[model samples]
Target: MSDSPHSTDGDTSRATLARVAEQAAVSMSTVSKVLNGRPGVAAETRARVETLLSEVGYTRRGAVVPGAPLIEIVFSELDNEWAMELIRGAGATAKLNGMGLIVTQSGTRHAPDPEWIDEVISRQPFGIILVMSDLPPANKDRLRRLQIPFVLVDPSGNPAPDVPSVAAANWDGGLQATNHLIALGHRRIGVIAGPHDVMCARARVSGYRAALESAGLPVDDDLVQPGDFHIEGGLVGGTALLESRDRPTAVFATNDLQAIGVYQAARALNLRVPEDVSIVGFDDLQFSNFSSPPLTTVHNPLYEMAREAARILLDIRAGSPVGTGRRELGTSLVVRESSVGPA
Candidate 1:
């Protein structure tokens, strides 16, 4: 004999359409019609059953629901105060736009991890903000494959053709700082540059050299040293520069942390700032103004840069094309007692 429509062949224990119908408080035929996507079931009945299916954790074969998209912010380093400030600015903007932020760390190794890109893609974030040092071609390709929108903050080299970026006017700031020292009659000027691989460091070095060349002064190789954008590196670099017989009348360190290191080195050497050797630094950090003689440095809007980056990411997520892929913010020279007429 033929089996009943709601029954399986001799398997009464198995759940069939009738069981689902009973649990959903609907007729067996109505459940059958809805399950088959037929035209007879009422819209309200269909919705009720669907809700029950979800609540009961039913997984229909070959079914998927689009998830909520998110945004990811990737940073190269998280230990520094500057990094913290950037996160605060980005976080504020993200919150304002009602978008979630997925913060990830890309180590200081050779390059960012391709696994990170894959993980980001798996999460299906609406966009990404790269606060990393520099991305290699492999990672870039992975990002391309995922088709995820991204913006870069303080990126190296020129902005990628399709990706938007925001950065400070580092080169111009360097020139301003160097020219300020030149105006003070500092013929023998020294520079403690950040790591060579860093784009900002390279740009500042270029600006410093340009200023010297523009002033008809020879660029002295002995007066320039490599600093790792750290206080200890600055201390070592400063000590080496100060110990030279032809010591510089003025010194320019890449950042305020380095500038503080310069101060410590000078104190050890019994050299009074501005009186014996004028000193200037970049990035007017919080403590720069509280130093012994108050550091004279270049003021770049770091928080503003981060905020703009977040805004750009939000716009991208909103399906708006960024008019310009690159934004370069300005910088100003902050004059203070730490720098004065060359002794």
Candidate 2:
């Protein structure tokens, strides 16, 4: 005999289906048949079950009930094209599996509110994906008690050893971007780095320093300007580097938005890209391709990473074993018109 559709996949035993069955005052098997569109049930009984299912917003594992649970996507902020790409990928995957994806913001805080967690527990979602944010330990425990699976997408900080996370190869990306600039005969290289608190940013900058060290060049603290990973941060950070008496011939903006900001700053100083200054960036956001001179960037594969994360959650929901560890996608340098040798 096949597994019963009435049975759920997780420890979430208090399913909406159970309540619907209790309210309809019918056998769970009868309700299951109606829910799955299986025949051989009385028309009156089926109608009752359908009505109760609607009233309760519940769907059994194989039920064709509407308003089924969604896969939640929690984002730190939805202010960038890269964030949209993550949504597009996860949404596509959820749709393919006959599920819908819902996006929620983390608000001004990097993590969502406790009330938000209460709401999520009430909804009893299939799973959740956290993008560029960390979950509080208490919330993590609550989710575990509720048997809700969650994965992190490019986690913003250092996650615990047991957390499941998907991300791009930040270290290699940083190494390769700086290596490309080095190959172009640009010795005075500067870096407009992101906040030190972010794990990816830290890894990228570390790779930059490693590359310079490997080439027998001294790592200069004066050449590294730390900023938030935004266009405005890039503008301020890039300006500071550019105004220095010993300004670098080539500079790397750790993220693409900052790269665009660097471009704006370059224009302000009457400097031409690939001529008076060279720039490289990371994340390869769609707009990078259409920028003034096109960006030389490290492709971070945000969409693919998000899609894989969704797949992992699906497997977990299906009671399949997904390893608990950081999963890293590869990154590579894409050369464009914005980078060249020192003038």
Candidate 3:
């Protein structure tokens, strides 16, 4: 093999596998494995070497060098059931396409680390998928500068025109849930919306208003409460709604987790679901059907959404057009024991 470093210019010499190995604190053979896109190198080690190379300004000289197409998926958190389903779907699609999926959690922060992004780009991944909520402006700018193919999944706010995305029909799901209650003669409907800034939350709220408007019912501002998309937040919000003198006959929660919290709130207030009050939730997570009364919820295809996003990234890498900018899948309501006519 050629170990001699090539001279790039008057004063700088081209980086070699040995130099990268030394800088990354690994054996030269390991560096060669990564440089030539060979297998056997651990994911974390590969990322380290890739980051080192970029930090030292090393550029590989070749065309279409082949192996597994490394793709990094950055997520805001991994604690949620929906997020786990999304990961599983994306991972399966990546495997089918002969690509490797690297999942990294960004703590509770909104944006990913700039160094991490540099590492990902240095590895020359086939593509990237950002499954995050409200990525900061600085991170967006950095991503734009990388000039690599990428797609966003569940972006919480407006995204740059260049970045493509795949999302669910959240507004329609919300509208459907609200309309279902309205049709059951529930005029005093309360809303337990998720985080105020989250895109899904905002869309669901919009749908709720639309349903009320269609039914000629005035939107009651006092009946609506914001939750942090967590069970505890739901419990607090649900309790407040239940304690009101003019309690709503039915309630619509933005997610299954929140809906579960509402169940607790109902028990605390000595109210039986669908008998004294009705409840409907979104995102039919695994446990939704097993809830005390079996939640009536809108089914969000989390796994399908993830798979579609991965497929789109693969297409982009292959230089094939994956249709237009953004793609949105539909949602449907699942009737269960949690909802019925207003009492």
Model 1, poorest ten-residue lDDT window? 59-68
State the RMSD for candidate 3.
7.3
User: How far off is residue 163 in model 3, in Å?
Assistant: 0.8
Against the reference, the lDDT scores of all candidates come to 0.73, 0.79, 0.76
TM-score for each predicted model, relative to the true structure: 0.73, 0.79, 0.78
CA lDDT, candidate 1, residue 34: 50
lDDT of 3 by residue, 1-343 (tens): 2331322342232345567688789997886565555667776787777666555555423211221266677887777787788889888998998777888776343567545654564465666778864455544543333335667786453444556778889899999999999988899999998886687788998999999999999998998998887889779989999999999989999888999999999999999998988999999998999998999999998899889988887776566877547777899999999999976
Candidate 3 runs further than 4 Å off: 1-67, 107-109, 133-147, 155-157, 322-324
For candidate 2, what is the lDDT?
0.79
Shift of residue 241 alpha carbon in model 1, Å: 1.7
RMSD of model 2 against the true structure: 8.9
Model 2 TM: 0.79
Which candidate leads in TM-score? Answer: 2
TM accuracy, model 3 = 0.78
Best by lDDT: 2
Q: Give per-residue lDDT, candidate 1, residue 215.
A: 99
